[model samples]
Target: MQKKNQLLLVVLCLILFGTLNGFGQKNQKNNENTNLKTSPKLVVGIVVDQMRYDYLTRFWNHFDEGGFKRLVNEGFNCKNNHFNYAPTSTGPGHTSVYTGAAPATHGVIGNNWYDKEAGISVYCASDDRYTSVGTASEAGKMSPHRMNVTTITDELRLHTQMRGKTVAVALKDRGAVLPGGHTANAAYWFHGADEGDWITSTYYMQELPKWVNDFNASDAVEKYKKPWNTAKVINTYLESGSDNNTYEGLFETEKTPTFPHSTPNLLDKKKDFEIIKYTPYGNRITTDFALAAIEGEDLGKDEATDFLAISYSSTDYIGHKFGVNSKEVQDTYIQLDVDLQNLLNTLDRKVGKDEYTVFLTADHGAIDVPAYLSDQKIPAGYFVYDSIKPKFNAFLQYKFGTANVVKNFSNYQFFLDHKVIKNMDIEVAKVQETIANELLNYKGIDRVYTGHQMMQNNYTKGIPYILQNGYNQKRSGDVLVVLKPGVISYPRTGSTHGSPQIYDTHVPLLFYGKGIRKGSMVNRTEIPDIAPTIATLLGIAFPNGTTGEPIAEVLE
Candidate 1:
């Protein structure tokens, strides 16, 4: 009986040990599963138009902790980021950032390019195949049809099996449409003036969502009726030029370009809401709308990763009107810093402090006003298209026996009338060489490459490489010209971009949040690399036409 009782006790002890072991193993598996997630709940991409890399350093002291500084201190900062191609305009810039390819591969050669076959200027985002969804204006008749490859946003949607949602917003149509890609749930741009509404095209949806309608119905534009002024103490704006300067372009109603400009005062002249774009209030409205999107769309709410692409276009508008050194430009960056802080705060509250990933970059940087550079004893001058166009046509006429042989000289390239050249029985390659040779003699022209040269040889460095990355064989022109450094084809007052110069190519690139390393890199990185880096962070496929390799340092 005693032996039987001892055996029963031993059996009971064995059963208890087995139960405890099973429970411990289950807990260990649960913890390991939680640690294995490779993707964030959401990705936010912010592109500030016409923002130079110097702007970050110029405004560094004025920036608050949560905006640019937050991105720099706690995030990975790529200080040497630049655009790898020429003609770094908005369309190509944004497309390159998202497609991981230059204009050559992605096919957004310029904001507007002369279509050689079509014999007409083609806007990059326009598509007559679809109608406007929100308003009856031509602004909504835009899509991503011009882009030849998939964007990172498009890849995310596919990786998630269509469960991930992508929504893009901007003041300019191309800014929103290109980044949104072919499969975006919606892409909206604001139409200012008498009809101030956020609009989209039928390519995404047939009607504006109820939330978008509600936003439009509200007095969102009305709140910005106050006059524009500096965000901080005006005296502290030592980083910029005087408030009144001849280098800055004036509003139609005003003579002197100074501070505290009135958007409403200028509204009477145009009778359109377009005047607001010239002020910092444009960025504010954009931030407000972005916040609304986060709430309305319920982003970052579930397992499926979402994406929000927001482009701040007012910087470009203001930079075009007021030179990069003007007080107004300085004021705009200060205001933008605050808006970014608000955006980051909202992400923390809505998406959790570490649940989302955010990257801030620029479409392209702008050159200093050529006039200003001249005054400062720098080598700068204007490349007037008005004067150069007629001469170029005359040369073509003199050589080919007819001016009609050239369709147009657009995006610093000559779109030769191919049919006309074939009809005249002239060798097209000979025509390209003859025209390219003559362009070198023009005052501002630095060098010229024929279509044949662009197609045959691959360039590795200098201006030739930059231009090569921008050239598209089927879509580009016959003769491509590169203006000398500090030479621009724009008016004297405001600055412009679209050069291989450092001022035009260098722009800020920052990555922060979930799965990103906290560090800084000063090595050379191009804008096209952004898309692949994001792809790596999200553990997704690279863009279809990607020519850039991902920055391994950015990944965790």
Candidate 2:
């Protein structure tokens, strides 16, 4: 009886230990699943239009701890970043970022350019065959049909055989269409003449998705109408120049380009929302749409990787209108900091800390207003277009008599009527050289390189700094013109970008979250490197025709 009782106690002890062991294993399994669900498989790419490097430091105090500050403190900040090509406009900027290639390869030279093949100026993303799926007018018709190379987003979708979702959101059509790549699930951009509404092109869908349509119809624009005031006191914006400067572009409702603007009158107009493009609130609207997209699409939910390309376009619009040193510019950065903080917090809640990765960069930076430079006793001056236009025409008239040699010269590219040149039997090369030589002699002019020369000269040296940084053979001008220091192409109303100057080419690049090293890199980095870095992070192949290497400092 004693032996039997001892045996029974031993059996009971074994049973209790087994039950506890099973519960411990089950708890461990639950924790692992939770971690897997929270962390994203890949990345989110955020490109801010016309975001200069200095803006980060300029408005650092106003940034929230969770937003811009989190990115800076936690992420690998590329202190010296820039575009490698001339004409740092929206199309090339977006193309370069995703393709990991410059305009020379990606082929989006400018926003609107004269198509030598069609003998007419063409919009970069415009597709006449496809009408706007979300809006009534064809003006909203745009796609990535013109893009020549695959984007990082395209590669991710391809890796998953189109099962993974890829989405892009921006205020500008090209901003959405290009970065999302050709195979994106959808690319939505802002629409509406008076009240901005987000819309998508037929390239991705037959109609606005139910979620997007609902979001737009909700009338979110009313939230901004509460009040329009500067984020801080006007006098506090001492970093910026005088408010009533002559070079600043006029806002739709505000007179004299001064602060303390009221929006009641502007909002009364049919296209009042257009003004939002020039305000920091535009970034807020864009972020709101982006969050809706993440939730509606269920991005990063499954095992497959997803991609989200978001371009905040208001910075570009505001930079163009207010110049770099206006009170408006300062306010925009401060508000943007706050908006970024809100965005980061949302991402943290939705995606979880370190679960998703983000890369914040710029399409391009801005140049200081030439007038401001001139006031500072710098040898600054505006591009003498009026003076050069007549000279160019005269040179053309002499070369091709009785022919319209000049169709148009804008966006730093000269479009010659090739039909006229062919019929007149004019020497195109000689005519281009003559024009180039003439322009090179003008004030504030640097060296000029014909397109042929740029293509052929593999070892050209002593090239003007601007030309060296800005030139891309295929899509760039037939004759590349470089400006002397402090000289801008656009004469009036604030600053312009398109030169290879440090002010325009230099931009900030910060990569934080998941696998990025915590440190700064001063090594020269171009926008093209962004795509390859993302591709490496996801373990995907580099973009086809990529000339840039992955940024080594940030990668494993």
State the lDDT of candidate 1 residue by residue for 96-154, as single tens digits: 99999999999999999988677789999999988887788777888999999999999
For model 1, state the Cα shift of residue 490 in Å.
0.5
Can you tell me which runs of candidate 2 are displaced by over 4 Å?
A: 1-39, 399-403, 417-427, 459-475
Regions of model 1 farther than 4 Å from truth:
1-36, 268-270
The TM-scores of all predictions, comma-separated, are 0.93, 0.88
For each of the candidates, the C-alpha root-mean-square deviation to the true structure, in angstroms, is 6.6, 9.2
- Residue 488, model 2: lDDT of 80
Query: How big is the positional error of residue 465 in model 2, measured in Å on the Cα after superposition?
Result: 8.7
